[model samples]
Target: MERIVCLLIFIIFNVVAQDEFIFWAELSNKNFILHHQNETISMAMTKSKNKTLEYACEITYVQNDFKEKMYDDFGVIAEEKMTKLDKFNFLNIHKNDLIDCFFNSKIDVKDFVKSEQTYVQSETYVRILPLRFVVEFHDNSAFIYYLK
Candidate 1:
């Protein structure tokens, strides 16, 4: 009885300590594409500044391009196919998780926290969420939640 109660408490504490945040961005032109070899995961796109776009890119898989089209002067057009991309490599930042990541990675988020701005990172891409304070990311991007 007491052991069961203790177990339940432990589970609840861990669950509350972890929070999840969702992130999203617009996929603009070719500049937004992030590719490795033949695989690609593009950005968000929208026609209206108000609504979401039709085609949002996510790295569902990665594959090697092997089929070759031999040209007299030029190189082959190698065949590309679907393969798996590691979820850990994908950069998906959630609003709440920003502070936690910074702390875990030994980064500073004091300024953003004080300013009430939501911070996100993607190596070359860093943003602050303003409109909704919360957003969603690809299912694979869901990460740890933080408190304080």
Candidate 2:
């Protein structure tokens, strides 16, 4: 009788394990899209701005021209098909990330840090973050953020 009871318990445990399922969160670039689960969170379109170590372009989804035409020496349409164009690329400057904005004319990190300006050399790739500073990338481009 004991042996029969043990076999029944083992079968029940195996069935319960088989019925269990797992869920996961989707990761793209620097964003995490989550769904409602016991161990996960649901992500929305507005949550794409969550702060993460990774970075990606937000405007990477552009469609190509769906129609194309070919011309011969006689200026006649030969073929029609889809065509693609070059993708646009831009820099993303977060509040914690370091940026080069040509804040100095000496091109020295020490000298720029000593001054009370929030500018740096655009050609240099440094990882120094300033405290509460503004960066003007172009004539009408200016942004303010904090350090890490």
- Candidate 1 lDDT, 1-148, residue by residue in tens: 9999999876665444222222323222223344221112222221123433222223222233122321123442211221112121333322223333332222212212222257443322233221211112332333232211
lDDT of 2 by residue, 12-63 (tens): 6544432111112211121122222111211111211233222211222113
The reply for model 1, stretches above 4 Å from the true place, is: 19-148
Q: Cα deviation in Å at residue 114, candidate 1?
A: 42
Write down the lDDT that model 2 would get. 0.24
TM-score on alpha carbons, each prediction: 0.16, 0.14
Top of the candidates by TM-score: 1
lDDT of all predictions: 0.28, 0.24
